[model samples]
Target: MDMRNEATHIARQDGARAASAQQGSAEFLTFRLGAEEYGIDILRVQEIRSYEEPTRIANAPSFIKGVVNLRGVIVPVVDLRVKLGCEKVEYNGFTVVIVLNVRGRVVGAVVDSVSDVLELSGEHIKPAPEMNTSVDTSFITGIGSVGERMLILMDIEALMSSADMGLMDSAQVLQ
Candidate 1:
């Protein structure tokens, strides 16, 4: 092929690649856990409610703060800080519960404070590095870098649906 034709073909391929990358972009609902910031897919979030003491369940894990009734449906609330092994777990006025709907089940996650929704392109999100980390990186889908801030993108559905959480069976979640 001629040089001009080759260059035009290459430009078209680059434009297509960029468009596909943008299509993989997603929005995340960011929140604070101790000093770190984390993000989850915005589509999974049902609503955000102020922190309220939930009914304690006997034999429940420490991280499982207990369950709350949301319009008759019982939703288990998991303290994200405790689950992530944070040393400090404080519930202040800014504390809120992020209600999530995963696999037809409703659950709530306790976060220090809700930040802003971030629109991140696929290029901005990098795979989580395989290293010895304080927080469990198993639940982390990727590391999103927006400007100077780094958001730990979480796989909330996987985390909540895991057998360890006791909310749902992992096998069912996989299906």
Candidate 2:
């Protein structure tokens, strides 16, 4: 089957499995950017907070909005929409910061807004499409079907390790 067809079929099967396994499944924290919804494993989420103005870093990429003081540790914040190359939009009442701990690093992801936490099964995850957007698909764990909405499951470790993100090089952060 073609990629699209395969993806569709997988989505359908995943939906069916999810419907039956809804009673007992792993939880994911869902969030949005523009119209697209995304999710991360709840195990990685440390906290969720209102959008805070971060200290800008020199020579950092556009998506890297520098670090924010979370308690005492400075954590870098990444704008999900910009990182995904989504169209820029004005930040209004919906902006939020999803603090995540991935591979021993605590980073905050700036998303449009958080939706809700969902329980999903492994069978309900579809592999990401290959040769799609410029954003590395390897960072995608799978595609989750939550009711009528589709949530992109992110691989937090892979995303944190990605060279382009510049997170792996972070040594001494502001205290």
Candidate 3:
């Protein structure tokens, strides 16, 4: 099946699975970056689209892949793998843009492939490991442990609004 059709299938199938999340459990959209699996709150996800080359923005950061016009709204696309300092990657059919609604703004994040939504309770989440002062891991809220799999939970809002990201100005950051 084509990527777009596959995405639609996922949305429909996963929507039902997501609705079954336990009352107090948190639902996360799991995705892969390199060899690691990461997750972000499902509420922040707007939609997922097949990868398409976006228009380049001059003087933009390398990690900022470019921008794509979604319907009438132009959304900035970010390569999460690149931004997170993962090894160089080759974009293929499995590559997809995860459109996110972050802090009232729409942005696109590129991920290798989306796994599936997972619901985890508080007990399943472990506190983020402390790192040295130079290492900034504030965006990581916690680690979700499921059976033998580990998922890194991220606060995408914080990551997109961070001063260094430059996607948001001081005014937007305040909101």
Best by TM-score: 3
TM accuracy, model 2 = 0.78
Candidate 2, 125: how far from true, in Å? Answer: 2.0
lDDT of 1 by residue, 1-175 (tens): 4554444445444534563467677899999998899999999999999999999999999999999999999999999888888878678999999999999999999999999999988778776654433334556667789999999988898789877889887667778
Off by over 4 Å in 3: 1-23
Give the alpha carbon lDDT tens digit for every residue of 59-102 in model 3: 99999999999999999999999899899889999999999998
For all candidates in order, the CA lDDT equals 0.84, 0.79, 0.85
Q: How close is candidate 1 to the true structure, as a TM-score?
A: 0.83
Indicate the TM-score of model 3: 0.85
1 or 3, which is superior by TM-score?
Answer: 3
Error of 1 at 168 (Å): 0.2
Q: How many residue pairs clash in each candidate at the backbone level? A: 0, 0, 0
Sort by lDDT, best first: what order? 3, 1, 2
Residue 144 displacement (Å), model 3: 0.2
Compute the lDDT of residue 117 as modeled in candidate 3: 96
* Least accurate 10 contiguous residues by lDDT in model 1: 129-138
RMSD of candidates 1 onward, in order: 9.9, 6.2, 11.4
